[model samples]
Target: MSTPRDLMIVALDVAPSRPLGRGDLSLALAGAEAYDLLRTGTVRLRGDRLAPLTGPGPDRLAPLPPPGPEDGLLAEAAAALVREEPYEPLPDWLWRRGRGLSSAYLAALEAEGQVTWERSRWLPFRGGRTVLSDTEARRRAAYRWAADEPVLLALAAAVGIREELTPADPAVTDDTALTVLAAVHDAVMELEAVRQRRALEAAAFANVWRGA
Candidate 1:
């Protein structure tokens, strides 16, 4: 099934070398993956922890037969967390998940020849970098992106991308895409607020404790 994660992958047609913008693509992918699994009935979510639904397979947790690769990737990620932590909120799981996942996903796409990256050695840093081979070309073609759907637009806005969206946008109108986008946006914003509050509270506590 072509899910939001798939859209995210396409939207991020940036070469591995370029900045993937300000938002966290990994978190975006994880949320999309969890929502897709929830919709597909291959998995069930309990308080942020994703658990496989009982089925014919000997291992309920095995990556659901890839309706698409993103499914497998997301399943693998979720499964790993379930194994490590008994229960972790999806957002928390996303923050604590390992690095390089976004790169891995892009590499898989590169292997499929759907996209390509070029390795480059720039000055001031001996370590070379990889960049999307034709970022401008793909960007020009992406003009039609998310025209029919606004979930991705919502994601962009949530991450401070500031897309030009109308009141008719799914995020504003409360459409199906909103189900995914709003959930992601709300979760991310709520988490950020919680984190800020905690930081402030800690600072206050430290000031008092240190003074005493």
Candidate 2:
């Protein structure tokens, strides 16, 4: 299973009570995709920018390498890569690709029978709870998460699952992975800043409305 998918499963399984912010999860997912692509040699970092190994196309958008990622969502991410020179910066790519990415992964997991919905009988109109299925994918993700696998831990930390980002894990010695993790951390912080600004704006507006 792909790292993003595994990360999603691990997030759902471990923190059902905490429930990740979708925006944070999406950023982490994008980072997970970046890390996996780098690991697989389907993409490389040209000094913190992504350079997907894709073929040329008419509109400058390109196709992914043959048999890109086994997961369709990940393959789609590869296709979304900026094919031209001045390739996208890692943080930019995360924000762009991460928009609604959590929903996409959730839908994909539902379709693959990796997740199921349990609705209250009396409140059928309301949204139901999503439960992970007892699948091999879940087991594999659980094992990796249990092992404190560096990539997964880093991704989880970005989403506030882990308390803090620590020194680099010896297991994640690759420069590419380290770069991707750093970008993820910065992107998540940027997102949190945006959220804070929006919240403050809303509160100010509310006070103005009350005064008026």
In the range 1-212, model 2's lDDT, one tens digit per residue, is: 59999999987788533447999999999999988877776677664223335532111222335657766887898888987775777778888999999999999999999999999899998988989999999999999988888889878877877666566553567777877888888888898899999999999999999999
Tell me model 2's lDDT, rounded to 2 decimals. 0.80
Query: Which ranges in model 2 have alpha carbons more than 4 Å from their true place?
Result: 16-19, 48-67, 165-171
Ten-residue region with minimum lDDT total, candidate 2: 55-64
TM-score for each predicted model, relative to the true structure: 0.53, 0.86
Q: With candidate 2 superimposed using the best TM-score fit, by how many Å does residue 48's alpha carbon deviate from the native? A: 7.0
- Maximum-lDDT candidate: 2
- RMSD of model 1, in Å? 8.3
**Candidate 1 on 1-212: residue-level lDDT in tens?**
43443544555652333334323565565555655555665444443223446432211222233343355565576456453334445455445552444566667656655465444545434554344444443443354344544555555555444444567665445433344455566556665688789999999999999999
